[model samples]
Target: MAGFRPRVPAPADITMIAHHSVTLLFDLSDGADLAHDARGRYGRGSVAVGLLPGDFRASGRAGEVLQIRLEPVAAAALLGAPADLSGEAVPLEDVWGRDAAQAEDRLRAAGTWGERFTAARDILTRRLTELTRPDTRPPVDQEVAHAWRRTLGSRGRVRVGSLADEVGWSRKRLSARFSSQLGIAPKRAARLVRFDHAAHLLAAGRTAAGVATESGYVDQPHLHRDVKEFTGLTPAAVATAPWLAIDDLAWPASPPPAPMHQRP
Candidate 1:
């Protein structure tokens, strides 16, 4: 979870890069407009943004907002419909309905960030627990789960074929299962993960050429195309993104690896 309260006015527009994880944004402000390149505009109070939200932007009003990132496996269980949200951003009300409204109210009533964080955690914990009861959807497949971990650990440099082989499943079978459960193909997931790593490198002042080399891209043009496809922005534009500026604060442990020069 991450909290933000802008001291100054919000940017007129802020480009949001695609990410591998599902994002939940709770707007404690009056309201904000979320415009997705594909889905048009949405008025957000509390929203569930799915994987690869494809070059969206948020504008209007600045106030306390909390964002939570959830892995697809966990989000599938919590939202009760991973496939439905694979590449879309839907209102939280669409998933949780009245429960969503109630949770938002509770969060708004909290006096401090700590209180708000606690309230949000309690709400999500209860929902996750209820969804994972014995009779609910089966737990995420063990092999698929491990594959996801390996992909993340390697920063998406792992091959899907190797992952399938390692997990003792045929490539076709692994792809089908992964898509059904995680709302993304394993190969696509790897690409997204790799793109995420490259994006962070760009944000950290690495040249596009350097990022492409270190992030496993074939060349700078490959990285450029991927970034443009995912974010609708050039690497240079993405480097100065307001959204990415707060990533370190929100996700500190996942910092980009040291520059090549810093390596032994």
Candidate 2:
């Protein structure tokens, strides 16, 4: 997928930050009145990127893009807040990193990975005391997100019983709490995490069969069905769908990650 032609903005140009992890993107694009169609909001352009968690759909009109990726745990630690995110895009300064203006200026000048990461680390160190609230409030479980993350990394599978056991909560309690906090059920969230992994593998050029086996799906067909359910496209279709494909390449494939436990 090299030599990807820079595309004109289609109606749904926004894509999700997949991979079942949190990430940071530095928006270097000019101030185009961009809308996060997923959240249904618009904002002025700036040198800030969001420290976002998994599957938070985002899109905007075309602009010069500058961004840095971060781990979910690292990102959540910096934000020090929880809940499903659906909010007005905020300046990078308000969250983790150095002074928003200074960082933006540095990125504009230095234009190097080192410079961008330095700014990212600065933000991670300086916690956001107030910008802790998600743009939208959905019942989501911090514990489940954390457990789901571990399950993915360890076994590439999510078992509800195991998650509840690890978090020291009953299955019913965990499901209820997860629903209340993330606005999704524990099982559903786990499915998204798995599906997210599948999406990543596909984007990375792993064949559907290999992804299915490695990601712990029963088979390729099962994986295909699940992917279609989570995202309306088949595995092959997702490969070219504007929203998902753009998302697949939105950031460096192997960006830094944060641990889930560090969030609370």
Candidate 3:
């Protein structure tokens, strides 16, 4: 959970790399409509941005927004079907229906960031509690959920085959089940997670060659291809990407006005 109020003049375009989290962005300032984002076309004052299969470009001020990032496994349950979430963003109203308006109202009425955080937490907790009722969305399969955590825990280095073996299922069955439950195939999920870790390594001053080896790429060129495919940028360019520049400070135990990036 974090809050971001852009102080710098918002760029007309920003590059958002694929991440494994589902991002919920609530606009407090009634900013301009978002265009060409993960959702292709999206705007509703607030949105839940999902894990784009690859990097994407977004246009909006990101002005005064509260950000809540959820694990994709948990996201599968909270944000409607994982399939609908991937490759696009969804309006909060789409999932919450009419109650989304009420949540926005409470969020908007908060007096301080503290108040805002409380309001947001309350909303999320309430929704999660509702899912615990007799029937909501079906719970994510335990094996599939375990596979996701294993993928993330290894920084995407774990082999998909091994994951399948561990779960005592054939790769074909595992792939199908994982994709259905998680909104993406296991290999692609690993690639996205790997790319995410490598990008951070680059941003933290590691050489591409080093990152490649450390991140489990076949070689520098392999790393090059994956990075380019994910971000459409060279490893060097990604090293200084504006989105990754202040990452060290972006996530604090208690945040202080960071940028509201929908997985950017």
lDDT of each: 0.75, 0.52, 0.74
Best by lDDT: 1
For candidate 3, write residues 2-106 as lDDT tens digits.
666566867435456777888776666654344435535645467777776355555565556666888888887776667677877767678667887788779
lDDT of 1 at 253: 34
Q: So what's the TM-score on candidate 2?
A: 0.61
**CA error at residue 183 for candidate 1, angstroms:** 1.4
Error of 2 at 242 (Å): 6.1
Q: What digit string (tens of lDDT, one per residue) describes model 2 on residues 40-75?
A: 444444422332332344445534344444344444
How does each model score on TM-score?
Answer: 0.86, 0.61, 0.86
Clashes of each: 0, 21, 0
Show the lowest summed lDDT stretch of 10 residues, model 1.
255-264
lDDT of prediction 2 = 0.52
